[model samples]
Target: MIIPDWLSDLHFAFSHRGDGQMSFKHADKDVVLESRNRFFHDKGLNLDSVVTGELAHGAEVALVTEADAGRGARDRNWIEGIDGLVTDKPGILLMTTHADCAPLVIYDKAHKILGQAHAGWRGLASGLIESLVGRLKSLNGTGPSELHAWIGPTIRACCYEVDRDVADRFPDHCRFLAGESIRLDLTMFVHRELWRLGLNPDYVTDSNVCTSCNPEFSSYRRDGLNTQAMACITGIPE
Candidate 1:
């Protein structure tokens, strides 16, 4: 698995090799599909299970249990409207897709509970991060201090401009770019949310890669409607 330089020592894993590449694996496939196939083909995963949602930018979190195993690379009968997924089952990869939205991954090492959340501005404002953490705690008795978090690549403050209406939705503590056009720092907002949830700042790692600034990444802000998203996935090795 390719680990980006900004997220060193987090122990949580994700792929970064597709950077600057325009192959079918990165361009055409959803992040979950690409990650599942890579893990399977590389002989790193024993279970082929993957779960995601319709991602309506809400705070809903779906639980992936043993019954949901081996569902990866298969079409579902109905899409669940959720922004986060959590599981303790080994080989059951929990994934969330993002183009410019920050992909948040959390792992509770003691309990082996892993979680992935999609945090766009709307999701962030809706308290998705807190919802995921609360669910993890309830399901696995995992506390904020015991969990490790990784914030993935997304639209950075340099390119994520927001109007007053959107900016007002966030807490006053969030950082913002100055000027007539107000750009917000989403990664910082996520970091603040982590802190608010009682997770130590030291336990959180930020990718710091701006999708809008880097041509290697897919960016809705840059490509408009044509942006292809990347996936951030996590699970216990079976």
Candidate 2:
């Protein structure tokens, strides 16, 4: 589990498969508890304090609160029709899962606001990034410039070949024709949108580590293998 340096104070972690699959999607809820306990043991958080969303691959972004904590620790919290979650509350670990899609993390220390989002191709096309940024901005006067963002490790254009239908959604600048197929670059796409929305280029960091190409992370594209899921979590620390 690695936390972005800019978000050093937060209880954030992007876990790889070796860290133990931090998921309860199967019948064994203990898998989630055991994995989370080990990963966050001395970090002042527990698996039961986590709040997660079922990735719907849409643009719906939900606002979580103190009461929403522990809703999905053992059982699915089931926030419907949403692909993103935002919160101003502390200690409640906000998380989402991904294999190929980019995990988007955003924070505004000035307002103590934080967000975690899953941006698969569907979510991206549905305006997940813009919708999330807009909603966060509307709260506490948080603007793009005030927010710091990290585009976590995901399948890059090198591994993300798509059909014309999927490729046509993105502009030419965001994709290129590679042989007979088109490849989309979510990192570049998000960075462009962030800048267009007024975020500072310096504050936004794209790991540029391709999950499919990098051996450190898991990739569905690399094999039929799932990541145990990349556990992307962000929150305000107490």
Candidate 3:
């Protein structure tokens, strides 16, 4: 429950600790459920107040109003075909899962609107961050300057090597390296996107922890297909 100082004002949660119930340490279902429950209880929210699903690594954004709050997490409904969630509703948590992929959490302080995104190579190449910011602006009339962003733990360029095809998908600005073997700085790319959207550079924070490089955190690129994922959750207090 002790969020990093960078995002303290934003009412958010993240885990370096792997969940035990989720099969994979990073994706332990039982651990995630327990964490969600604890988050809701500690925040004085109902179990039905958290919203999340099986992220598809796409650009599809789910608009969560009060009605949809907590449905997926509590009901165990399949959140198929979606990669992001946004809401202005209080007490409703927006969550996303990741191992090496970065979890980007955005908040509009003035409007109390928050967004959670799953940004991997595909989602980042697809401009999911821009789309999510645009959606938040449309829903709450809050501009990018009013938003605060946090980029969570992910595979850093030092440890993340991609093929040319996958690396080339990003624009020149987003690409950190290019050669027979390429390294992509996903956290930096997301930060660049936030700046492009007009959010103040000072307001953005990066965890700077690389999953692939750190043994304490889970890493699919290092651990292979069976690695677990960490969940990043954020919301407004009731």
Which candidate has the highest lDDT of all? 2
Off by over 4 Å in 3: 1-6, 21-47, 74-76, 176-180
Per residue, candidate 2 scores C-alpha lDDT tens digits across 1-238 of 3345767778877777677766666326777667767777745567666778888889999898888887666677657678888888888888887677889998987998888888888888888998888778867675678898989888999888888888889878889988887898877888888898888988887777788998778677775644566677777887
lDDT of 1 at 42: 59
Question: What does the lDDT read for residue 59 in candidate 2?
Answer: 93
TM-scores for all candidates: the values are 0.82, 0.91, 0.85
lDDT of 1 by residue, 1-238 (tens): 2343333422234444253211222343454445446654553444246566667788998888867664434444213678888887776766556678888888787787878888899988888999999889987765699888888888888888888999899777665657778878878888888888889897787777888888777787897655555655567766
lDDT for 38 (candidate 2): 79
In the range 67-119, model 3's lDDT, one tens digit per residue, is 77655664457466777888888778777767788888888777878888989
Compare candidates 1 and 2 on TM-score and give the better one.
2
Worst ten-residue run, lDDT, model 3? 17-26
